[model samples]
Target: MDLIHRRSNSSSTGRSNTYDQLRSSPYADVIYDTTSGGEYLMKLQIGTPPVEFEALIDTGSSVIWTQCLPCLNCYDQRNPIFDPSKSSTYQDLRCNNKADHSCVYDLVYGDQSYSIGSFATETVTIKSTSGQSYVMPETIIGCSHNSSMLGRSFSGMVGLNLGRSSLVSQMGKHMQGAISYCFSPEGTSKIHFGSNAIVSGEGTVSTTMFMKKENHVFYYLNLDRLDAVSVEETRIETLGTPFHAVDGNIIIDSGTTFTYLPASYYSLVREAVEKVVTAERVTYQDDDSLCYKTDTMDIFPVITMHFSGGADLVLGKNNTYMDYGEGAICLIIICGPAAPNFGEAIFGNIAQNNFLVGYDLSSRLVSFKPTDCGVTQDIPIDDNSISAASLFQFNIKFVLFVFVLSLIRL
Candidate 1:
């Protein structure tokens, strides 16, 4: 997932208020909240001072990058610099693309304010309340020169979400088995770093949207009000495109800002949205995301994507449209920032806000359900650490299969 939606990084406007529910959970300790909120406060060490500010929890962005003191392009910062010099365990792995790193990535957001120096290998630690600390390895991070966007004045981002170079994937190498986590927005959000032991919870989570094909990533789609809107919304008014894509895989990233679609499909969607929204209202257009204006009446009728099993997902007015400004919204929308083959679509935090995504590292599964809040929770599936059986109907299906097979054989 590339840049989902960027507003050409202007110098600065009015400072916005940031809110984050950051807490520790037994399953995943680093479940930090990166909502529209600016930043959060956390003690680097048990005795260390707690620093908080705005941070973009990007599902699209894999690396957890942050601004430092020496950055020339650094933007409005409110907190003290993270003095890497002070920490005894601090060491810049210095593994850049120049060295034995995978891909040399030097990216600048559309704003061109913050330029990131991509590098692999870094040391990460948590300042535990009991004065104890644990370190995780194989995590990649970003060094930012500048930071100025919706949120402001922040040290850096705490990214352990899913993506190609995410800390989860990198740490998985050393951790051995898997990493299970749930982000509790109610001051209970914590990262369950390094182990599946922490992901235990009561209740069985279910869904057919989870796939363990490649590295097991979470994926879900709800077209707002597919049920109500489909009455006159689209030809195929449904939820997810039935039968999972055998062609291209999908990833549910919390860091990304917007969604991406194939060129042809995007065009069709634009046309569908255009049918309801006139051209005059939704005129602004660009590369990353489609910009549109909405009138009082055009509050988002409906946008449905027909899926298998005849199950139609009905996205409400909110999920159906994007908010651009006051009394107006994006009519026909398309969010594809740095998307590959135009096929790789990203369901960024804004969209993910609608669902509670549970990631089971040990089982290699991601489950999603209707959630009003942005914080993804562990759906009370069964008394199991990982929501495996709940995500995939495999366990239930297998039991029935065995029973029927036994009956037939008998």
Candidate 2:
């Protein structure tokens, strides 16, 4: 199998420094700011009676888990915690189970947040665009206990990575290995699977996805250049050097709110942006964001990201700039700590709004189609080739659950 490997330094914790908590605080009541596009959640049903949960759709990490009953130190969530005892189809996985590996798993997040729980498999269900419900039994899941801060609006999280146990991979065979999501910064979004996941036709552009064999959880893309240029063809240089040949230099993260660039690249981009904006730039001592006093964004120049495979993404003034409120506007791009080997550039969800992003695992390619996601019509699912028997047949009484150790405590 072709896998996309994730490279992490052998730091004492084996996690990235970007998530290190600079301030000391209690983990239970941590609140994350969402004004900058923090996360997106989707609805799903699991187990016998089919309990519904609003799960955070995360592409950066692999591990599908939810807070369950008998919670020991779980966070206060908007939705009721899932109770396994109520689900007739729920079953626990034992360490000695033959068909299954170990029933226990430990997880730790980049933020030093952790969860411990049991890993089990159960029936998973999702609604189609037609409002019809589809069920896949014997699906892998984690019923977390002693969980900490998670997105307050989220009941749990759905893993959409390349790992074998991820929701995408678990549904790949039946869904033709297709998945797509269209995010709206102001509201919620829908996640499509199976035949409904295809994003083709006009306004669609394709790009090659780089995958390594070792770690396949993160999506890597080749970013050629990020530049701001005048219509006159005059090259405007950013902070650092012009450009470097960096292959698979960045990861597209839907879970994160802000886009992060290396310090040098960020300085260059910010300088170029400041030159054209007529609004007065100001900095807030309480926050590190660079803000301006203006309601008009059209006066700003267009920023274009040239990607591999000749796909150029042109950012609109509105997409690149955001309203910081109180008559203040701020640039969404942030300067991240530099990483050796260009290991830290992240294209976050803020920059991906109003676009239909699709991942075709079979073809090993990712596609971006420009559309007004807030009003885009749901694509019809074509399940003609799937046998009817397979749709309703329940495989071996599958059951598992785990406490997620690494989750976004929003």
Candidate 3:
């Protein structure tokens, strides 16, 4: 489960958009979204009057930005663009303004997608799972004037990372530096912030997070190895090599669709999985998927991802295989082409289903507990109507097991 990947935080101009989060009152909420299997979305209400904006919750990217008014060739969006003129609380940051505004930010993605905008601060609100409206004022955000590829599908993106500009990092002392999310099999998921984000129980497995100075925004994990188990077991070790180390070679991102592994290592994993399954391997001319025509996935082996600190993620048939329609089921794990100077694995959201994954930045630990995410888990509210001591609870658990991780950067 040891992961290794190169950092892609630089822009075309060689300038890094290092946005610092403004210290403010922190509050937790559960944002709900029903997205395609590719990515998770969040319903957020920003500004003073609180206009609704649907954002793609991305852990890989930092800086929560949205399209602003006076567009300079903006994308085709379905939602109404955010107009700072309408909000009295909105303030545009100027490069020369020393009072509060610091500097303008320019962002560029690894895929060459870019956004240029001025730094701004405004009030952001979220509807908590407790049915209470919580607001965080003076929140730092990017009011983009020029953005690429971010059109009507989403108004903007909410950054949830360890970076200074990330939503979690900006929460500061208001939140206990913890965040968790539970994704259902039906593609409905909810994100929890603050103290309630902690995952505890017999099934919860905790692992130490590895952080590197160069890549501070992304959350890294110590992936030990991967195991393919059917009648016989096939093992692929990811650590103890110079390529894999404590600095963290693997990234767990919620926005990515499939788990990516390096080509060479993935070949070994695919061969092992193919040997254990009796279904015929089918290849499409236009698609890059390892698929088979099987009525059920039980014929395939269960994959276990073993990580450092004894954290094991046991992936069942539902978590490992996906239906591609027309009686074809494809494996969710993908083998990516080898990149020079980078050999890291990416554990995408597809592989994280049916589990309550919690990230505690203060303790530098990531905890995972298997649960029926299809069932809703509500947070306890401190209200007189409901006694805090006698709050409702559920009995869900996880099996501590591990699987192999493919080392792929992109």
Candidate 4:
């Protein structure tokens, strides 16, 4: 099989200051994120009596975990658990040692935990507009015995491995084209699989190539023009950084709802942002991230993000800070675990709101442009890459570099 290769900018230290995480996905009728602000959903089935439920489509994870009947520790579950004993088609994919990412394991979520198992082959059915039935075979699905509110209401996760294994792929065995992701943040959405799989309305958008490696996704930013005037002390620079070549490894994460930067770039951003803001009244939420009181910040620094295809992408206030249940977002600076390491940033959901995002795996490219939602921005349109006539199926490959190690932890 032939593949598209991407280049990277190197540093004198030779240490890779990049963050890329990969997960695997496989299921039937499994539509990845296909809604605006991503309110995508999928149909799910439980065992024995065969319980069917509608679930959210998640690609930021690997295990296709779900909640099932006999759920020992399920709590405040808004939905019914799957009755595995009643389902005649349920089969287990012993989670002990399996490469299909079907090995069962125990997972712990905030204030809740559970046992997870896998299914190697299962029947997944999806419907088209005319009620057309499309099914997936031998799908790897995860079952959560000890469940919680987070697992019960949702159907299951669809991991997006590097061009392989996904709920969309399993269903694609019976569909028309590649899967695309369309997400927005209300924590409620649907994920579509196959042709016209991932869709949104507005048609005015552009395209560019993405930088990927191994099983990870890397993205590019035209840093040379990241700022209109002086951002901080030094001129925003990416003269020599990983994935800085005309083309290299850059990643966009649906799961990681924040922007991450390499150590050096992180430092520069912090230093520069600090120079503009005063030390007093500066709030410290976490060690890795930071922001000053918006009122105290100096003249709003114009951050100019240069995209590959000559697109000028910009971030609204929400992109820099999260509400954290508060009414306002942090400004002047946002923090990731990297604090100030390299010179790269990982784009997260808050930053991607309403923007038309396109990732073309077939051509190894990713692109983004502005959008003016009824309440979001005043901008005109939000469209992205690919063509309906050509059937664009860009296989997204994720490569997880390290645990909280080199990545900018939000």
**TM, every model:** 0.56, 0.75, 0.78, 0.60
Q: Rank the candidates by lDDT, best first.
A: 3, 2, 4, 1
Each prediction's RMSD over C-alphas, in Å, is 15.7, 17.3, 15.4, 18.0
lDDT of 4 by residue, 93-138 (tens): 6654556545555644222433454444565554432222333445
Off by over 4 Å in 3: 1-37, 96-103, 110-113, 128-132, 150-152, 187-189, 225-232, 239-243, 338-343, 382-410
lDDT of 1 by residue, 202-321 (tens): 332332344445444334332322431242446632235331253223455555445455454455566666676553553444434444555444544565433333434444455546
List runs of model 2 lying over 4 Å from the truth: 1-38, 96-102, 111-113, 129-132, 187-189, 225-246, 338-343, 381-410
- Best-matching candidate per lDDT: 3
lDDT of each: 0.43, 0.65, 0.69, 0.45
lDDT of 3 by residue, 97-192 (tens): 555556678887644567788889898887553344657688999998898753236777788988888888877755767888876655355687
**Candidate 1 global TM-score:** 0.56
- Which structure among the candidates has the greatest TM-score? 3
Q: Is candidate 2 or candidate 3 better by lDDT?
A: 3
Clashes of each: 49, 25, 25, 67
Locate the minimum summed-lDDT window of 10 residues in model 3. Answer: 394-403
Q: Is candidate 1 or candidate 4 better by lDDT?
A: 4
